[model samples]
Target: MKCFVAVLIIVTLATDAVSEASVRTCEPIKVAMCKNIGYNQTGMPNLARHTLQADADVTLQTFSPLVQYGCSSQLDLFLCTVYVPMCTDKVALPIGPCRGLCESVYERCYPVLSEFGFQWPAELDCSLFPAENNHEHMCMEGPGERTAPVGTVTLDSVNAGGRSACRRLIKPNSWVWVRGSSRCAQFCEAEVLWESGERRAAEVWLATWAALSFACTLAAVGAQLACGDRGSAGERALVLVALCRCAAAAGWGVRAAAGRTAAGCAKDSTTPTRMLLAHDGLANPNCAVVFLLLYYFGLAASVWWVVVAGAWRASVLRPSVTTSGTGTRNDRHSSLLQLAAWGVPAALAAAVLVTRDVDADELTGTCFVGNQSSKSLLALVIVPEAICLLLGTVFLATGLRAILRRPVPVPAPTALLTSPPQQITDQTLLRLGAFAALYAVPSTCILATWVYEYAWREDWLAAPVPTEIPSTQPRPAFWVFLFRIFASQILGVMVAVWIATPRLKALWRKIAGPRKPPLTKCPAGPPPTPLTLHCYATHSHSLSRSQMHKYATYRPPQQHSYRKPRHYHYSAGETIL
Candidate 1:
C-alpha cells in the first residue's frame, strides 16, 4: 500500500511539471506568432490581436449553425498549431526553407478566416510588413507607420526554392492576393468587381433612352425651325428647350458609350488585371469635361426656357398688353431670355470646372461635379437645378392661373353679328392644365427623388450588412436611379409629342404650298346693241343764228309737206330725215 501511494505521487508530479513547462513555452510562442505574421517590436500586436479577437468572437458567436461548425473545425486546428510549441516549431523548421511556407500558410488561412468574418489581427496584416521587404511579400504597417507602396510587390521574381517551399505547404492557386498602393485604389477595384448584372441592365436602359431622346429632340428642333415666321414665342422657347435636351441626350449617350467600354474591359477576364487597377478604366477626364459642359448647360437651359415660355404666355394673355408696336420690347425680352437660358448654365458650369474636381464612373459616366462620396454634388448641381425648377414651376403655375382666370370681354351685339363669339371650352382649360403638369412632372420627380435620397443617406449607410456577397448599390437607390434616368430621358419624347398640334400642322402645310383662286368667264349675248351712231357734218361756212333759223324753217316747210304726204316712220337705230 505504501509503494502504490508513492508511485501515484510520482506520476502526479510528472504530469504537473509537463503542464508547467507547456504554459511557460506558450508565452514565447505567442510572441513568435506575432513575428511570423510580420509584426515587429514597434507594432502593438497585442492591441490589434485583442481587438480582432473580440470581433472574431462576436462574429463566431452570432454565426449560423453551418458556418459556426465549419469555422470551429478549422479554428481548432489553427489555434492548436498556434499555441503548441511542438507544432509551431515543426512548421518553422530550417527558417530559410520555412520562410515561404510561413507566408503561404498565412495567405491560405486568411481568406478562409475572412470568409467566416474573421479578420486577422492588424499585426498579422501583410500591409503591416516592413517596407524594406514590401517587394518580397504583402505587408501591413503598424498604426502611424508610413504606408508602403501597393502593387509594387510581386511574386514573379521569387526564387525556385521559395516557390517550392510555398507549394509544399499551400496548394496551387489556393490564395490570390492583390495589394493596392492606396485604400482608394482598393475600393475602386472592389467596386468594379462588385458590379452586378442589375447595374449593367440599368446602364443599357439609360443608353437606349438617351439615344431615343436624342433623336426625338433633334426632330423637334427641326420641326420648330421649319415653322419659321409662323412659330409662336412659346414654340420658339420650346425649340430652345428641345435643342438643349438634344445636347444633353447626346452627351449622355457619349458618356454611356465610354462607360460601356470601361465595363466591357472590366468584364473581360482575359484583360490583364494590372490594367484594371488604374482609374482610367472607370473614367476619362477629357470625355468627362465635354459631357459635363453639355449636360449642365442643357439642364439649366431647359429650366429657363420654361420660365421664358411662361412669361411670354402671360404677356400675350394680359388685356393691357398688345404685341402690335412692341417689336423692340419683344426683341429685348428674347435677348434677356436667351442670356438667362444659356448664360447662367455656362457660368455655373465654368464655376464647377474651376472650383471642383470632376470625375466620372460607370454609374454616371459624365464628368459630373463630384467624386464617389458626392460630398458637394448636391449643392453644386442638384440644388441649383431644384431651385430653378421650383421657381420655373411657380412662374408657370402663376402665369397659367392668371391666363385661365382672366375675364373674357363680352362682344357688343353688333360685333357678335359681324363675327362669331370666340369660345373658351372646359376641354381647352383641361388641356392647358395637363400640358403644364406634364412639363413639371419630370423635374419635380427628379428633385423629389434627389431630396429623398439626400435625406435618407443615413438610413442607407446604416443598413444591415447583407448575409451574401453584398450588392454595390442598395435596392432603393437602384430603383431611384432608374426612375431618374427614365424621367430625364423621356422629356424629349414628351416635348416632341406635345408640339405635334393642329396649329403647327396647319402652319407646316401652308409653308408647303399656297392655294390658287378659281377662274371666271364673260357672257356672250351683246352683239345686237349699237347704242350710238357717229355722223360727220362738214360746213363750208359759218351762219348766224337768224340765217340758220331761216334756212332750217324753209327746209322744214318743204320736208313737212313731203313727209305729210308720205308719212314714213324710221326706227330709233336709224337716222331720221
Candidate 2:
C-alpha cells in the first residue's frame, strides 16, 4: 500500500512537469503583482504577466483580474495589460550591439509567475536536441497537482517599455488575439501601437498654429506702427490692414482645424477599429495655443481702438473755452466734428467685439471668451476691460459737459456788430460742438456697460456670457463680444478715416480763410495841413505893432508856458509889446 501511494505521487509530479513544458517555448508575460494571483482562485489558474514591445509607437500595458473578484482596495485590485509581440518577435528584428533582441525590444520582469505551481526550468527542450540520444532516454517530470493556494491579485506597478514589436508587424490583415481574462489589455496595447502616425500629424498641426500666431504678431505690430494716429482715412487704412491680418490668422486657424479633422478621418478610414478613439493628445495642444493667443491679441487691439476713439474725442473737446473779444469764454465747433469721426468707429468696434463670441462653436479653437483657465482669470480680464471702457466714457462726459452751456453769440447792431466776431472763429466753435455731441452717445454707452459690469451688482461681468453657462461666479459679457471685434480691424480703418476726413480738412480750410477787416470809420479826409496860429494880447509894453499884429494874426506857439494870466502872449516869448 505504501509503494502504491509513492507511485501515485510520482505520477502526479510527472504530469505537472509535462504541463509546464508545454508552454516553455512561449515566454510568460512579465508583470509585477500587487497581490499573489494563486492566493484564492476557485480552482482556476492565475496567468498574470507583462509583455514588452520593440517599436517606438507601442507604450505599455497592465492587467488585473481582481476587479471581477469583488476586491475593492488598491491592494486587492491587480492591474494587468498586454504587451505587444512575443520574445520571438524581437529576435527577428535588426538588434543593436550590447543589448540583444530581448533587451533592445523589451524589459524583463522578475518574480516570475512561479507562485501558481509553475516552474521556469533553466534547461528547456533539452530532449529536442538529438545529438547522441538512445531511442528511450530516462527522464523525470514534476507533480501535476499544485499545492500552492491561490490568493487575491493586486496591481503593483507599471513601466513604459519603448515600443512594441507588434506595431512593426501590424499590417493589412494582422489580427491580435487577446486573452479574455484581462479586459483593458487589448485596447491599451492597440492604442499605443496605432497612435504613432497620428501623433506626428498632431505635431504638424501644432507647428502650423504656432507659425500662424507668430505671423499674426508681426502683422499686428506692423499695423500699429503704420497707422497709429487717429482720423478717418488713416484709421480706415489701418483697419483694412488689420482685417487682412485677422483674415490670415483666421484662415490659418481654419486650415489647422480642417487638417486635424482630416487626419482623424483618414485614420478612421484606414483603421475601422480606431473610430471611437479618434481624438488624441497631440492635436489638442496646437489647436488651443494658437487659437487663444491670436484671439486675445486681436481683441486687445480692438479695445485699444475704442479707447483711441475716446481719446480723439477728449482731445477735440479740450480747447472748448477760448478767449472771446470781451474776455469771455467761447466754444469751438471743430471738436464735435473730430469726436464724431473717432467715436463712431470706436462704438462700432465695441459692438462687433461684444457680438463675435456667439459664432465660436464652428471654430473649435479657443478664443478670447471661451478659454479662461478659471473664473478668476475671466474676472481679471473683464473687470479691467470694463474699467477701461468706463474711464473712456468719463473722459468723453467731462469733455462734452460745456457743449450745451455755450452762450449764443450776441450780434452787434451796426455793420461792425452784424459781422461775426474776429476773436472766436466759426470753425473753432463747430469743432468743439461736434466733438461734444458725437462722442456723447458711444461714450455714454461705454459708461453704461461699465456701470452694469463693475457697479450694478457684484456680478458685473455676467453680461458677456449667458447665465446658463456654468460658472462659479459671474463673467463680464464684454469678452465674448470683444473677441470678434478685435479679430476685425474695421476700427483701425475708421481711425484712419477720422484722421483724414473731408470735414477735418474743411474745418482747417474754414479756420484758414481770409480774415475780415476790423470795424472802423473811414479815415476822415487827410489830416488838416500843418498851420501856426498866434493870439496876441494888447498889453502895456510899447513893442512893435508888427509883433502885436503877428500875435493877433498867426501866432507861433511857445514850447513852454506858465499861467501868468495878468498879461497873456499867445506865440512870442516877449510879452504883448
All models: lDDT? 0.49, 0.34
The parts of candidate 1 lying over 4 Å away from their true place are 1-195, 262-286, 361-367, 414-434, 457-474, 500-504, 507-577
Give the per-residue lDDT digits (tens) of candidate 2, residues 315-424: 34553443342122112433453454345444543443443221111122222332211222234344544554565556556655655565666765674863565444
Per TM-score, the best of the predicted structures is 1
Model 2: per-residue Cα lDDT at residue 411: 61
What are the root-mean-square deviations of the candidates from the true structure over C-alphas? 16.5, 21.2
How well does candidate 2 score on lDDT at residue 566?
Answer: 33
Clash total of candidate 1: 10
- Candidate 1 C-alpha lDDT tens digits along 1-577: 9999999999998786465344421123333222353322221112123323334334333323322222122232233222221212222110111223334445545654565466665433433323332434222221221222432222221221222222222122221221211112212233431255665777788889989988887877766666654343555566667777788887777667666444322221112222232222224455554446455756665665565546555653553544463445656687787777777787777676564334444354444553222444577667777777777677667767776787877878776654532243234334444655577788788778767756654333332334787654333457777898899878777776665554468576787787778877767886574444322324445556675455444343454342222123334476522
List TM-score per model, in order. 0.51, 0.32
On lDDT, the candidate that comes out on top is 1
